[model samples]
Target: MTPSSALKAESPSALETISRNPRIRIRRSGPPAEDAKCVVYWMQRAERAVDNPALDVAIDVANELDLPIVVFFSAISNFPSANLRHYVFLNQGLRDIEADLAERGISFIVRRPPKNSLEALLTELRAAMVIGDENPCREPERWRSVLAHRLKIPYWTVDADVLVPSGLFPKHYFALHIFRPKLYAHFPTYLVKPENPKPVRQWQRPPNFESFDVKEDLTEGWKHLDRTVQPVDYLTGGTHAALKRLKDFVANDLAHYQDRRNHPEKAGTSHLSPYLHFGHIGPLTIALAVDQALKQKVITKEAYDAFIGEVIGWRELAVNFVKYVPAYDSIDCAEPWAQKTLREHARDKRDPVYTLEQLEKAETYDELWNASQMQMVKFGWMHNYMRMYWAKKILEWSQSPAIAFENAVYLNDRYELDGRDPNGYAGIAWAIAGVHDRPWFDRPIFGTIRYMSAASTGKKFNSKLYIRNVMENEPPPLLT
Candidate 1:
């Protein structure tokens, strides 16, 4: 069968275009395996069937090699800091993946751990080559590094999650001013969606090949898995759900996004962070939607600028942070000034130092902070303005700055649906250690790091109404 016109990229040679693209990182240097069965897409980060450059690359490679392509998603129960809330949403996305892949004539195989690692499954399938999506988080990056050392066949991974590939910037940008110009410089070239071409040959699953039932509980029997973080119904997972949310945001809230995003009491911001974290939705998808809305005069220029500033500017800055900063999740990731200032304030008195347990339980003197914690714990999400205030309060109250960072990370990773993401890590670092922030007048505990007072933060928004809204959302189990 001939390749469709849509499959043909700008360059005559699709292979050259893909291989030379900055987004595609060649993990293993080798040619396709001899007597290869098929091309495998080790879908992990970019889990969606549409607008996923990783899957597109795999399909392109399979078409170029004249072989079918199969998608291999590891529904491992042991993903670090992941829990029942995360898995339930992930599994929902998997259902959409299977359904979507079937329409494209691609075979979707859902696998579990113990015997079903990417290496084991790819080898079992006699894969010619493997393509994967990028995840900048420490554990996942380390997994890729180990696989690069261990895999015999060629492997390539696409930075499918971010609008701009993190590879463009070799090092972390200390501030958004430096990163924003660089981001927009390449936006015209990189912000467009992938071709999403279908494979020339549909994948044929070999005899004896096994996959877990799509409807079965992927987390079942994993005793170590944290089931305490129950799933929330307000924000369901999957590409369909993500797209719906984007549509709703554009239609209903985007026009007023600029005014209301900072106000926690209003439903102004797009609540798509969980979907973005889970890779059910890609940044390109959301950015394009917002851009389209702007062009169509559906939203004001100020609103568009404000929303894009967060999505493309600050969000990609976080991606760059985790990719380049070795100690991204800790106080060490802070700038030199931030580090020095923190050291100077090491002995600063913390009047009401809170233990990790106390912080986790939201038993703090600050009522606004307590409301934010309850919001995160009860709904698996929180308002961004509150997140900053929440982290700053932790720094002000914890035994030490390092302890504050550690406790913040533990809580962020433990409760929030978007925890364990670059944004979360970067947010924590910013709040505690001033990673992407500039130093302010020297202050207690926080030193020169920007201090967010609860009173001022609450004043900026409807603090009372926000607290009431959070409480009214649901009957929180542990909160009064």
Candidate 2:
């Protein structure tokens, strides 16, 4: 069937699930194989089986072409700044994907490649066409570029990362106010629930198929990986856990979300960041559930609107910003005015300068700052509002703005389960250099970049209560 006719064949729910312009066809190295055994999905970013456009597209195309579907995921053994904690979280989610695919009679293969060797695996499989998920990070971007250049088969990138797809805004948006109307206009179309595409033929292992051990020892066996940072005992990873967290939040805390979201002590916010970061659940799934709650009167319209704005509005805006803005993790990526003003204040003296070690060790003078650091370092997450305060303080205390940006990114990416993501990068940029925000009243160290003081945190919420609650059980620091 032609591409247009394929869309015409799908029901409204299925159309809502996949995208109209999901496929970004890379340069065809050669014509597709006439009798290829299977359609290959190189799962990179969107790691889930459900509510994932790339997987759905692959399945749909496989059904159309009368081929079986095989999902391949390469586990990069040396991911940047990834420690035991990061792997543990990722492995937890991957286990779920493996089991789910098994139940569906789909073949899912995972391998730990040496370096940029995904093409070798594809060659071995003789894939007719390869499909992949979209991610804006430097590493994945490079991988996709290389694969597109080298692969003899056609490569397609399907963006399952954002509600309003990245193609909508070909340029960087200055602010959320500018994108609000654009987002709302597409909400009804994109927010509908998507059904999984069923294959006409299930995959079976070929006689000469190469198979490596899919078993993982998240706790101990991965000696090749860095194991310094251990996983948090509290949070479990996977779609099941993410959905449960969403259910509890909407049932209890969502109605008061607007008023209580900023208060770290309340613990009233939805703790779904890790799940979203891992692609355990897509934004549409959460948004649809929230919409259903609104209709059922489980949550008020005001609460639903506020929650949706954060998930669809602010969250998607961050994704959009990172997608369009090159050098997104660095201070150079800030708006011209922000860059100029920040440079103007570069020489401003920082009192009681702290090294990255001091900051990382949570040995700072301020108890609140130390506690917030402890929360992130120990728990692998931090409340969003406190994160703003945390990054601004790094700028205030570090030797230079450049160094401050580096330190903030390092610690955030190292600890947060949601680290190394666009939200993390954009959030740090907003905190340290004011990327999306407008110029504020000029200050000594902050310049025109927005300033967030620890004292202001006290005025907003009970800082002492938060510190006490989060840091109550931490033991004293070990001597060097």
Candidate 3:
């Protein structure tokens, strides 16, 4: 069946994008068998079964072939640069996905690939066709490319994580101004309702594999890390938790989102970044809920539009930028003019240099910076506006631009539930290297990149109130 015809046959939802390839590619090594009858769905990025475009597409192809669909999840014992906090959050999400798939009669198997050995497991699975979630990050992309070459059968990647497929954009954008119009053009088609997964008539289960115990692994793993640092206790990780948070945000917080989003004291911003980063809850689900609220007149048009602008516009904008620019994580990817200015001011003396260790401990002199760090330490997440200030302060306080970038990325990835995401990388790049930002007033260390300071935050909002709130509610960090 033609891809277009297949899409038309399904629900007329704008949430899904169809694959044009006749046969999905498999990256495992083997000669193609004419009657090889299995479609293996990659379950790494898009963890949730529902509101997932890749899973939907894989199911469609499997149904057409009259073959059983098997879901594959590879949990490497040690993902590069991942700390205890990162592991705990991801493992929790995986546990939830496993249960969700079991209820749908889809077999789920997780294999702990030895450190740096994903290919070995792919060879063992010998999947006829492989469908993977598309991500622009280094590790996922590297794995995808290696699998594509080794596997003889057709392999395909679906853009399930973003509102618009990353392939739609050509290059990294300078800022929101450049990417907003492009996203707005595609918003109507991307924001359509999603089709529910059709139940399988006959269940065919794969061999049972032991599910990894997230809590146990986390407890054992914490002993290996420095005993001084603590884990974040902001929100529990999982698809179920993510869905509940989204529902609560829509029902209560979204109406006040426009007004209190910038206020660090208010629970106005939807604390769904970590869940979205892990793909526990997809952007489509969030978009659909917001759209419904707008139609029901629960949120004003202005509020709804504001929310959509972030979910579809800015979020996809970052995804598209990373997709097109392979070196987006590097400082060289910044505009030539910005790079020149930054280089010229590379050695400008910082007022008070803070080592990565000091920053991690929330020991900085600035009370506001300390408060934001405490939030990350205690809650595993920081407010959206504070995140901007928090990152910018890292640039201002560190010994060098590169060191500052490394420190910010490491601390965020280690502590925040939403760290190590494409958005996380992009946010860091924007904060330190000016990836999507334009040059502003020249300053030491920052050069021409826009500068943010606690003073500016104080001028904008009640800084004392923000600090007081965090101190009052701060939870003890996760124990080592």
TM-score of each: 0.94, 0.91, 0.87
User: Model-by-model lDDT, in order?
Assistant: 0.85, 0.79, 0.72
- Give every collision pair in model 3: 24-154, 25-154, 25-155, 26-153, 26-154, 27-151, 28-151, 231-478
> What's the C-alpha lDDT at position 22 in model 3?
25
The per-prediction tally of clashing pairs is: 0, 0, 8
Q: What's the distance in Å from true for residue 99, model 3?
A: 2.7
lDDT of 1 by residue, 91-209 (tens): 89998898889989999998787767788888788999889889998889999999989998877888999888888888878899988998999889987756889999987677767
Segments in model 1 whose C-alpha atoms lie over 4 Å from true places: 1-14, 474-480
Model 3: lowest-lDDT 10 consecutive positions:
22-31
lDDT per residue, candidate 2, 1-480, as tens digits? 323343344323343333346344333333446678888999888888878888888888777667898998888777777888988888888878887777667888777654225687777777777889888888878878887787767677787877767776767788888888888898877887887867788877877565444455533445677777778867888877887888888788888888878887776778788888889988988998898889999888889888888888888888888878888888878888988888888898899899999999999889889988998888888888889999999999988888899999999999888898888998998998888789999998889888887778877888888788777854221111
Tens digit per residue, CA lDDT, model 3, 1-480: 334443444322331233553222223322223474566787778888778888877777566555567777777555556666766777787778778877777766665534223444345555455677877778888878877777666566677888776666767777788788886787787778877575453345445544444444643543454433355556778899888988888998898778877777656778888889889999989998998999999999889978888877778877876777676666655677777887898888887999988998888889898998888877778877888899999988887777788888888877777777778778888888887778889877888988887777877777788798778875422111
What is the model-wide C-alpha lDDT for candidate 1? 0.85
Q: What 10-residue stretch in candidate 2 is worst by lDDT?
A: 10-19
Q: Every model's Cα RMSD, please? A: 4.6, 4.9, 5.2
Q: Give the TM-score of candidate 1.
A: 0.94
The local lDDT score (0 to 100) that residue 321 gets in candidate 3 is 65
Between the candidate structures 1 and 2, which one is better when assessed by TM-score? Answer: 1
